[model samples]
Each structure stands twice: as structure tokens, then as C-alpha cells.
Target: MASRWVLVAVSAAQLAAGAAGQVIALSEGRAFDIDVLGFRGSPARLGRDSWLLGTGLSAPVLMLSVQAVATIRLAAGSSRGATRVLGSLGALMTCGYLIEKEARGALSPAGWNPTTTPAVAAGLTLAVTMAVLGPRQASSSS
Candidate 1:
């Protein structure tokens, strides 16, 4: 597949995940999983449908890894400087994912927390990289 298209798809996907994360974070009537778990002790006991939706936000977090590597590889064909930027973005994205996952695990334990800003920033960086890198094309022979 064309590398430029890959970046586009990944960027769009990142944006989607970001939106989902915000939705999960803002959903009302949600409970702290530990409290809910201790009380109800079952998935049904989890309460708040949004808790289930919160887990879905990670889909884009994981996608950022694929986007970053693909962007890095595509950048390798152009400028080393651009490659570094792509690589850095990719690393940040991965770190964001790990950080969010860890934070969610640490804080919520029973489900996703959707409260990490770093993850959101990392996702934004990935989206920006797609724009920064622009479309890939064969070098002009001139």
C-alpha cells in the first residue's frame, strides 16, 4: 500500500480515538470501578455503560504505534530530519499509550480511566505528523 495513504488512515483513526476518549471521560453517572467491583462483583455490577465504552478508546492508542512506524519508514525515504521527527512522534505515541494504560490500571483497576492527558497529546502529535510529513511521492529526477 502507498505510505501516504497509510498515514492518512492512521491519522484519521487517531482523531477518532481521541474523540472516543473524551466521550468516555465525560460520561455522567459513572462510578469508580473498584468501588463498583467491591460492591457488585460482576461485569453487570460494573454499572455505567460508559465504562465499557472507555476501554474502546485504547484502539487508537495502539494504532498510533502502527502509524508511527509506518511514518518513520516513509520518512526514511525522504529526509533523515523528517525521519527523526516521525520517530520521536511515534515513540511519544507509544509512551502515551503505555502511560495511559498504566495509569488506568493503577487508578481504576476494574476498567479504563480515560483521564491521561499525555495520551491525548501524543495522539495529537501523531495526527500533526501526518500533516507535517505531507504526501509521499517519487523524487523528481531534475
Candidate 2:
């Protein structure tokens, strides 16, 4: 929130999260609803089990709107609220990535994912920490 770099980092994380959701949904296949992806189709035909699927930073319009508006607010340097929202969104995105990977493999086999990258991991952590705990307080010279 203090530096432009943090804003860029958070924004980048948001974009990554959006992409990650799409990839996860595609990989999920069955419960992946076209409706959730902005098209029209009932997930019932695919035997939808978990609402968690087709959700996250790619959940229809909610995430998109939230991310868009929040990013704008942040870029304007207008609100800490924006950072909080950004942080929360980042956490959700990171969680989706992690959950999908873990369900596929319990720290075991099955190749890699965007979430596996160290930069992605660090970015998400920083964003989440910013949201939940706010930017680190500067040490007082007093």
C-alpha cells in the first residue's frame, strides 16, 4: 500500500489468480460450469458436487468486478480498503491453487502447477499478510 511496487505485486497476483482458476476449472472438467465461466449451462448435467469448484477468482462476475474495482481504487492511492480486498482475493486465489494441487496429490506425484512457483507463493503470502495484518508498521525513531 505504501509503495507502487506492492500495488503492482498485488495486481500481478490477482491476474495470476484469475488464470489459475480457469486452469483449475478446466482440469476439474466434470463440475466445471460454463455459467460460472460466463457462458450458460447447468452444472447438474456434469454432476456438480462441490460449490468450491468453478469458484474463486474465476467465479463468474463477482471476482472480476471486485478485482477490477479494487485495483482501480488501489492505483488511485485512495483506500486501504482496496488493499484489504486485494489481500483477501489473493488469499482465496492462493487457496484455490493449493487445494486443487493437494487434492490431486498429497505432497506426492502428478507434475506441477502455476501455484507451485516460488514467486507465486511469495506474492500470495505478501498479499494475504497485507490484507489480514495490514502493511508492516514502520519503526518509530522516538
Candidate 3:
């Protein structure tokens, strides 16, 4: 029961954070562009129509939504296997983000920042916890 609630809370947090990021990106494109793309130039000079940026932002939001739904299902007494699968998907999304940040040199100068590292950690933790818990199987009564 406690584990289920923990999963719910973590999933909700991820969903909220992902939504907030999208809102920020839409409302303040320049700032989002600089923080994410590591643009050294002025924010005002940054263009907003990059498909790469759209893809980058879309993936996490989608995964977070999926995780939230899975958490809800788990809370409703769904099988742990389903929840674990969704959790793994979320972790995979986080892994991709981590790799992207590394490849883009985002973590090179400042080490792990507050932006995506926490999300990656949370996702991985959730996945591991779910995996450890294992699937809830039906009882076979005689």
C-alpha cells in the first residue's frame, strides 16, 4: 500500500514538472531555449521553430503522462507487471534525456544541474522499486 502511494506521488510530481516545463517553454520561449539548448547568444535572437526542440520537449511530456496513468492504475489495484512496464518506459525516457544532455555538453561545465538530473533519478528509482516489488499474481485456491 505504501509503495503504491509512493508511486502515485512520484508520478504526479513528474507529470506536474513536465507540464510546467511545457508551459514555461510556450510562455517564455527564449529562456527555455537558452536553458535547454545552451544558447550563448541573446535570448531575443533565438528562433523558435526548431523541430528538434519540439521533439525533445514532446517526448518527456508524453512519457510523464503514461507514467501518471500507470500509477493511477496501480493505485486502483492493477497488476504490478503493468505498472512496472510503464515505469520502465518512464525510465527509458529519462535515460534518453540524460544521454542528450551529456552529448550536448550540458553537464560538462556545471556537472548535474537541477533541470533533468532529478527527473532521471526519480524515474530510475521508480522503475527499480516497481521491479523489486515484482508482479502481484492471482491466488490459486483449492
Tens digits of lDDT, candidate 2, 1-142: 2554465455656565555544554455424333323533334533243333443224333564676687777677646576667666656655544544332232234434454343334434544554543232111111
| RMSD to truth, every model | 12.1, 7.6, 7.0
lDDT of each: 0.43, 0.47, 0.46
What pairs collide in candidate 2? Answer: none
- Residue 78 of model 3: what lDDT? 48
lDDT of 3 by residue, 1-142 (tens): 5655665565566556455444543444422223354633233532343222322222344455666677677668745654565556555645544544332333345545466445334544544444343332211100
Give the Å shift of residue 85 in candidate 1.
5.4
Q: Per-candidate TM vs. native?
A: 0.35, 0.50, 0.51
Cα lDDT, model 1, residue 21: 52
- The candidate maximizing lDDT is 2
Which stretches in model 3 have alpha-carbon errors above 4 Å? 30-60, 102-142
Ranking by lDDT: 2, 3, 1
The runs of at least 3 residues in candidate 2 whose Cα sits more than 4 Å from the true structure, single-residue gaps closed, are 1-4, 27-61, 101-108, 113-142
- Count of clashes, each model: 0, 0, 0
Q: Could you say which candidate leads in TM-score? A: 3
